[model samples]
Target: MSNWVEGQVKEIKWWTDSLFSLILNADVEPFTAGQFTKLALQVDDKRIARAYSYVNAPSDPNLEFYLINVAEGLLSPQLAKLKAGDTLMIERHATGFFTVDELPASEQLLLLSTGTAIGPYLSMLVQGDVWQKYQHVHLVHGVRCNADLSYQDKIKQLQAVYPQLIYTPVVSRESANLGLNGRVTEVIKNNRLFDLMPHCVTPSNTQFMICGNPQMVKDTTALLLDRGFTRHRRREPGNITVEQYW
Candidate 1:
């Protein structure tokens, strides 16, 4: 039996020159929200594959993945060139421990992501379990520029339906009217990030899920550690849970 199954591209949504969402139709096994699966393409008889977090909820009929075209990337540049009806190989099963189910009980859930790393949080948010599980949900997306912030409409819709969901968009490069204007770590360090939120962010009341570029994840986790938060583990059960989006 083959582990890879064929997936037909249904649509390509370009949010910016470098960022896009690839929507496909494939018969993949049920995946939990916030998990990721691999997508592959055959190049010169050698298969190249990369892992992408699912942007769509498990109930959604189609599979959606948000990605940025790395200028010199082996697979992403080719992925960006794909058009409707093109076929690619998708891993039959998804895997990751980023799901909300893995977190311990807490009053607040802080989901922090940078760039396309926001995809998994979008999945968890749309799936509707986060709202019921946490009293307050803070979704912070940090992007280099205003244009990098995608899915505003979807985030707004989710906010409308779930008042408990609070979104904060941090733009590091330029000014943005929507949310705070600084890097996520900088804002948090200066207490500006906490000022925007309605609830307090103590380790006892909040559980942090940090995902994004390796640097952002490392810095954020370090800051949280400085504030007395510890890395979450199955046996130890601490405060911070992280997934590095390479």
Candidate 2:
């Protein structure tokens, strides 16, 4: 059984053929910037629930989420059809440890994500508190095409406020004439990411937070471990934190 509260669908933003964002108006429990909450809708006799990371800052007036529309997904396709007056089920409490606060203080924080996985990082960015802990913060977002780079405008706004924030949007398939062109794992391995940064991205001075496709998460984690980065844990603090989005 789940304790779910109803939230009004305040708005919807469709970014591309497969991507969209939902804004829900509800009074939610105060949550950490990078936590996620479950959204549900009744389908026939069953309640289909899915977890989505918040794109809005914890203090933002409305709850926002970025999502990918899976044609066959039980919930996402239905979610795509929602309108302003529709109601959605939001979990009473948010949950997840994929936040900057969970990592040890470091000189630089590298946030790596792909597709809608960038949602939580966006929340952390807009909250504007990560700037106080680390001198430098870098967000590397990977997508298949230029059209999929959804939040450049928002990132630009944040960069204006925090000059230390660095954003690198990577297009893996098409050459966008924008940022880098390669898988984020390859970019990090080949030293291309550091080339654009002010400081070196080493295990000693950098903490890595990775969120994205399962394959990307696995591949990236393997690469980082080989380079001496350890996975973060409750008892043993290390240089890497990861969340795999399905």
Candidate whose lDDT is highest:
1
Q: Superpose all Cα atoms of candidate 1 onto the true structure and report the RMSD in Å to 1 decimal.
A: 0.8
Give the poorly placed runs of model 1, Cα more than 4 Å off.
none
Q: Distance from true position, residue 138, model 1, in Å?
A: 0.7
Each prediction's RMSD to truth: 0.8, 1.3
User: CA lDDT, every prediction?
Assistant: 0.93, 0.91
Which candidate comes out best when scored by TM-score? 1
lDDT of 2 by residue, 163-201 (tens): 989899889998856889999988988988878878877
- For residue 234, model 1's alpha carbon misses the true position, in angstroms, by 0.8
Error of 2 at 58 (Å): 0.8
Worst 10 residues of 2 by lDDT: 194-203
Cα lDDT tens digits, model 1, 1-246, are: 888999999999999999999999998999999999999999889999999999999999789999999999989999999999999999999999999999998898889999999999999999988876798898999998888889999999999999888899999889986788889899889988877667788888889999998999999999999999999999999999999998
* C-alpha TM-scores of all predictions: 0.98, 0.97
lDDT of 2 at 8: 98
In the predicted model 2, the residue pairs found to clash are: none
Error of 2 at 123 (Å): 0.3
